[model samples]
Target: MITNETKENYNQCQNVNCSTTFVSHETVARYIIKPQLINVLIPNG
Candidate 1:
């Protein structure tokens, strides 16, 4: 479920080697806010 009470959500993957916190250069990011978690689209590669 989603509620409209979130201040900040980090969808960045757990990839420590991701290089950057937020990468909007190549792939498209789809932000999804849930009850207790945030989801975002990331490149499969």
Candidate 2:
């Protein structure tokens, strides 16, 4: 692990044949709509 935080994480591959690094993000929704509301807006036949 290179860096770790509440919202984001940074990591690197640990292989002799690989040199890959990446960052991952954590997120939360500010607001959510119910499934029923989604169905009302976008009906499925």
Candidate 3:
């Protein structure tokens, strides 16, 4: 069901910088939601 609570959490708006503007969370989600490797081998022996 489409609820206001979920809308507020996912569709919230905010400024990324000092500029007087607004942006939706979905914008950042595109850059954040992705696959990545966490573990890595160290070069030192």
Global lDDT of model 3: 0.43
Residue 22, candidate 1: alpha-carbon lDDT: 57
After superposition, which runs of candidate 1 have C-alpha atoms over 4 Å from their true positions?
A: 1-10, 19-45
* Winning model by TM-score: 2
Ranking by lDDT: 2, 1, 3
Cα RMSD for candidates in order? 16.1, 8.7, 9.7
lDDT of 1 by residue, 1-45 (tens): 133432343357677888356533333255585357668889998
Question: Per-prediction TM-score, please?
Answer: 0.19, 0.39, 0.19
State, as a TM-score between 0 and 1, how close model 3 is to the true structure.
Answer: 0.19
Tens digit of lDDT per residue, candidate 2, span 1-45? 333423777889999689699998766545475345344466788
Model 1 TM-score, all chains together: 0.19
* Model 3 misplaced stretches (Cα beyond 4 Å): 1-33
- Total backbone collisions for each predicted model: 0, 0, 0
Model 2 segments beyond 4 Å from truth? 1-6, 28-45
True-vs-predicted CA distance for residue 18, candidate 3, Å: 14
Error of 3 at 39 (Å): 2.2
Please give the TM-score that candidate 2 achieves against the real structure: 0.39
Model 1: worst 10 consecutive residues (lDDT sum): 1-10
lDDT of 3 by residue, 1-45 (tens): 134222322332355664454433322323446668888878997
